[model samples]
Target chain A: MADTATASATGGSEPAIGRGLKGLLLVALPVFLVGWLIIYPIIAAIVSTLFVEATDGVQFSTASYRFFFSDPYSRANLALTLWTTGVCAVLLLLVGLPIALYLRFSTSRFADLVQSLAIFPMFVPSIILSYALIRTIGPNGTVDILLNAVGLPKIPSPYLTPWGPVIGLVWDNLPLTVLMLTAGLAGISNSAVEAARDVGAGPIRVFWHIILPRMGNSILVTISFTVLGIFSSFTLPYVLGPASPEMMGPFMLRTFNDLYDPLNAKTQAVISFVFCLFFGIFYVWSIARNQRSQSR
Target chain B: MNRREFLAAGSAVAAASALPSLALADDKTIQVYSGSDNNIIDFWNNTIIPAFQKANPGMKVKLVDAGDDNGLRAIADRALAALKSKADPQADVFENFDARLPAGGVEAGLWVTFSAENVPSYGKINRAAIDMPQQLPYRGSQVLLAYDKTKLDPKDAPKTWEQLVAWVKKNPGQFIYNRPDKGGSGGNFVRRAIHEVNGRDPSKFTIANFSADYAEKSLTPAWAVLKDMAPFLYEKGAYTSGNTQSIQLLSQGVVTMVPVWSDQVLQAMSQGVLPETTGLVQLTDLALCGGFSRLTVFSNGANKDAALKLADFLLTSEMQSAVITQIGGFPGVTWDNVAADLREKYKDVVPNSIPTFPGGDWNAAINDGWYRNVATGLARG
Candidate 1:
């Protein structure tokens, strides 16, 4: 603080080169750190795959990337990741939005309890949650026993199926979604809500007009997080989903480990990273746009 | 102190502090990269390394956990990376499954070969485990049919792959196997099916140079069998992703029977993840694939001699017996050398020794082929 204050006070007195050098020094360390940790690894992985020599020669080739894109198996894994991400994102919003609204508006003890419940999932480890889901919904599990006691026929375990993963993913992601939405809702001025209410708007009308539009940025963030989380997550899908159409995380893992193909795995990882970057751009844009709007 | 004096004094302290560690790191630590869990590593640290360290003074063995089951792939990746970079490999000793190591690590020329004459414990190792030329054996594992004894009568259990298929057809949704590409137990089952279809010829699959055309042709019968058995599997033939998943199902009594590794089943049973009534059977007419977890000395490692000695120590009857007793895997040494209790425990469960894994590119190709051909419906299902 003292150094910053002294620098600011003497800003005009200092030469332009000195100030410029200080500014560069301030930013250089952070830039280098980010470059070394994030940018360097990603570029190295891409470059390695791109320049990977074929068994015959030392010539650079995109054969690995071509193989990744051309293979039906790789295509299927990408498709599965996208499908699970989209479905889970939509489901999270549908389930989390209403709960967020209730927690935002309601003053009852039940709402407080619900808020605590929403935060509870964030505390549980994903692996433990996966096992819990298996024990709860797997065949002859607690759910099955309860259903049987109620005279309902026992259903097959969903452990190795898509629905199994969808259910587990939603359960895992709900708390985060609700928390983000509630934070967004909390940001909305009470006066705006009250003014709409004073104009004789019903609860639903006030929410539809005032609250929903205000939370657009939050919704976008929530969706972005949901998509990225579901897209890259290894444990939930690995433990719950079937073997064939695995998410990219497990798919890349098997390609590298089970198949012992590092080149192809690197290619797949680069491709998945590219896929995530598309969503990542939108997230960055949303944050920047949100910050701009707030400044205004 | 002034800035100059303070900086100089601090640098001196840091350099002095780092010197001992640097000295210790120089040609002293033998890094053993393995794919076992912390528990297994703990077993090594507590039981094996101390004795080995005492035997060979001025040697330190560091256990680096690569990851589980699939960690051999990481070791291979590291070896490839080291070769590409022209650096000494970080790991001096690598402990991994025989099937997991690609052709003795000989394909990459990354391994130091061990002769029985040099390794005294090699004479005591089981012949089945001695198949790999460059590897020193530690413990062996076979794929076994793990079943809920409460649900399956011991006498009524299927004794062959054909009978197993018949039983699955008879009682639909009560049997399953994991995806061949995901786990070794599942891969073994698929390989066995292919073997049976090719007139029980193991040689066709073990070719060093994997011919895609031959694999496609020879695997036709196996694919057909899988297609037939698919509809009768748990959840209408949706196989679990891994052996653990199938084991979980068997434990929950979700499925009556599933192919599981003997070591995994034993561990699960002792941990109470499997019920007391859970039974293991090595089929009478069919041989499940079995192989040893091996240790190979890296040729480009810093401590090759110490690594070789460590590998040799691992193959001794005492260590092999300890492996069986502690980890619940078969002893790499002859069964006669194993403790009587350990032998009796696994006598009914151990499968006949089979030398069938096509260790080179054939393994990956066959696994991929199975996924593409037989497991096509599973993704959609």
Candidate 2:
């Protein structure tokens, strides 16, 4: 408080720097609480998952890692997570591209409304969306009601299956994906687009040759954000997901709490952190690298 | 005053308003911690608290449903830390038990012995209910077999472990139960099964030595049965959702029957987690394990005596029954058989009795048998 007061007395960029620090603290306070409650415990679980004994002060080993993924249940779960991510990402690109473009060119009020709706998922927290999806698709839930209306079999929720988590992941990541794509599309120079149209180029040709080339940097931004969102999401998948092929969050929990094995949990946490760290670094780096090269 | 100070002061005031007047009372409100559900907490608050408080007017039972067993365990850790500070703990009582009980909690003065004389209907509780200061619930949960009669039909279902395994072989994935290390309910099943199957003793926990590995090897028979039962699981040998899963599967018609909390089965029926055909069974040679989810009052509780009084009230007969009705809180203390009229609504659909876990074998079961076998060490296979 005294330092901030001193900075304000200086009444220049020093005050601005102090305000920035205050803003940083405002952000950091919640992050610390969230980290303690949701993040660190999860990290503890990962550490626990790496070692076999899970006993306190035990050294790290790959035994748990070997055992967990060696079995049919764990093995099947890994495949499920990978395949689901791949399929969902492709599906997102296909479905999200049109929505992104529609919002880019049209200046109509309806177009703006559509754009808002497209990105609404970003504002809607994943936890709320995940629950709503589960309730809707759960066995004997609303989906079944619709199925019955269409004279279909009473297909129960695949909630206990891997696909259940997939829907949650896509729903959570989609809004942000669309948001990034829209930003990229909107960033294309209007003058260049107008010149192309004035020179008798068709709209489709213009979009493919000029607008797309110009917006390459934005598209990369969308990919980077989407990948980051998918990699880091903990809640939507953990709750909606099945016990088999348990993700990093659930596995970490089992190690530290149920197993009472912190060493292994810490190892697991470190490994997960490493995985996310590398993936994020590569993603961000690629976006920056692309932006730099494109400026040429 | 500055806004943050004002808010912090307001917090203290709110805390003060919520505090019970303890100055003139021998017994006062006991603050409780649990991982149990809100519905369960509400059940304790409305039905259990009033009954105990009515008898001991000075007592008001305050339950803070922290989360689940995990949340309760964390609260226990915090209280233990506060005990070190030689100060009053934020939490008065917490509910949980695991490998940490003997080594971590009980030995740590996080627990003190609870008595029946101080508790209402303590004498009526079976000897098996008092195994350790830790396992005994002020309220006990019974580990009994719940079978879906529609699946087994006219054959009168399995009456013994041998019969049950045979049934599982005939109808794969028709029967299921939880793994022990996952939670206490399953751990109870493992212990009960060991006592019934191999005649192990709970009081004799030591095996040539106190090494956990020794305990692990001692559980061969129980694991052998589980190994055979494994192939017949609902997911065909996948890890189950523990006790709760079996009840849900019974409701979904996925598995015919499995072991679960007797109260959970009843709650399942109430919540529609179990189908009507599903009912509980206590075998003639039946063995069942029981554990307490007690209101464990920490020594450094803010109001220690008041907490003790609240704990005492919760253990009373009237409060136990109230816990039974709403929280489906199982009664550790013996009560008059619930009204025959009430039984008729759930009796045939539920078990006639909670299978008694062998009193003679808890030590062997928990240490080498249940703990070693299912929890820490899997059978060599």
Candidate 3:
């Protein structure tokens, strides 16, 4: 690995104009596409959100913000979305960590199968899952049938309530989280583990101190992606939520598209976009900060 | 070649190009704006458009699926705004609901004054329906109360508005309808709530303050009926996805009773969305029929002749029957063909009553500015 690295280092030193152009092409192409398509859309949505107004003709008003904050029901929905996402993230991290560790350390085929199942939900469309879950737990559905067989109370439709969407989001996100977390654990240098064993440290202590720290980048990556996946989502909340859970994304779409009220929808969309913007900036700062350390 | 020969060649080229344009000027295509769904558009393509095509081979007809009621309104708004700014109107045909035509179309001058000159068949449509606000050209169908025959015992079936309410209270969440703000049926339900509530004549409803909100306050009896019946709605007062979802729930036995417009159920049966066992039922005393509206030729279009011919063909007897038998929707234009024979053959598959407006145009659930205010109220609630 060191010799190939040296050869590449030497290769790069050669004064080839085409190689410099190739390097420029490689970096610039991806940057251009990502900026123009993805970043521009995000920026456009944020800008459009600011244009919404109240009937009094108070242009550039914060009436929507006041309305959202004043409504206890809407507040509860926001709190519910946040709480559900946080809980689901923690549960996924806890449950996924051990499975990831086992897959890294164990030779059992069953553990391998568990790894596949853990990641399977990512491939299945979320709407199909919501439909299946609804049918399973909806009144007079399979869950009710089984419960009646055992003399148990029947589960209601939209069984998760404020957290129904969270459950769906977590299920969708777990596969990617497990795959990433497992890869991080598996990438642990064998020499480091052996060195710890040679010293006075035990297996659990060595893992907590070394393996987990080495995995911090992966952990942060998981958190960033899971936050993104759960936030700004609409379909799950739209389908699985109670009659009106009022998630930022779904609420905006319903207001704009269904109700034909672009003003309120744009306002809500803008609020949600601002949150996304802050989160995105934090991610960029983290990546840039890490790059500086690597450069040093 | 000589300069004269070259000049002659150029002249011939220009004439060849100019010939097609002149032919196209006389034989033009009328662009009709429709807020109806693509399925209904497909019904026109398969049934009505062909009938029009057969009659006026000299002209062409174009239908733009404007998407929804607001979509139609927005299209009209754009055209009117353009016209005010001295730009050409894009669509030759203006088709939309009764509520919007008068509010936006006629008031804005995006439409021509209704005269016997363009549409001769205007006389054939029930004069009362023609006098309706913007619904002058056509009368589309809206749903009345309907139920599953297999679930409803014939003797036990609801016959009157009061009896229906009483029966609904006995079975609550099993009753379902689309949200009014969501679809046309929702508006129908809001209007019907008036009849069920106050014993006041529907004619009094055309006056100011007779909005559906009035139905809420004045029609305490109807609300009382609904309050008792609410408990029995599908999934114990849960909403279906929308109209389509409500019907799906009913067909699935997730709900037993739902209100689907006259055409919605028939269209569903055609599309196989619902089973054959489902049947149509309207409350006695012709529960508030929020009739569907249709398209008329715009005065500002490039192809007026072609458009008028197309409009005429669509209203003909052949086209109206084709709409009834093949794709289910209430006929906007009258047809001699849609008489007793077809009704007897199809039985209750079609509505026993094709609701018409004798008491002026069937009053919409709410007029323009009034509806916008009430909508905010519904949302706030």
lDDT of each: 0.80, 0.62, 0.63
Interface RMSD after interface superposition, each candidate:
2.0, 8.4, 7.6
Q: Please compute DockQ, using alpha carbons, for every candidate against the native two-chain complex.
A: 0.58, 0.16, 0.10
lDDT score, residue A133, model 2? 71
TM per candidate comes to 0.86, 0.72, 0.72
Ranking by lDDT: 1, 3, 2
Scored against the true structure, residue A215 in model 1 reaches a CA lDDT of: 89
Candidate 2 lDDT: 0.62
Model 1 Cα lDDT, one tens digit per residue, B1-381: 777998999999999997854665576788887786565787788889998898888888888777765566666667757866877666787776453354445767777767876576677777766656677777778888888889889889888877888898999999889888778788898888887888776665655546778767887778888888888988786878777878888877788999888788888999999989987776666578876677777777878877778878886667777787777777777788866787787677664465557666776777777766776666453
Shift of residue B65 alpha carbon in model 1, Å:
3.0
Q: Taking chain A of candidate 2, what TM-score results?
A: 0.69
- Poorest stretch of ten by lDDT in candidate 3 chain B: B372-381
Worst 10 residues of 1 chain B by lDDT: B96-105
The C-alpha stretches of model 1 lying farther than 4 A from their native spots are A1-23, A40-72, A108-112, B1-31, B49-62, B69-91, B97-110, B207-209, B299-307, B339-345, B378-381
**lDDT of candidate 2 over B26-45, digit per residue (tens):** 44457777677566666766
Quick one: ranking by DockQ, best first? 1, 2, 3
Instruction: Kindly report the interface RMSD of candidate 3, rounded to 1 decimal.
Output: 7.6
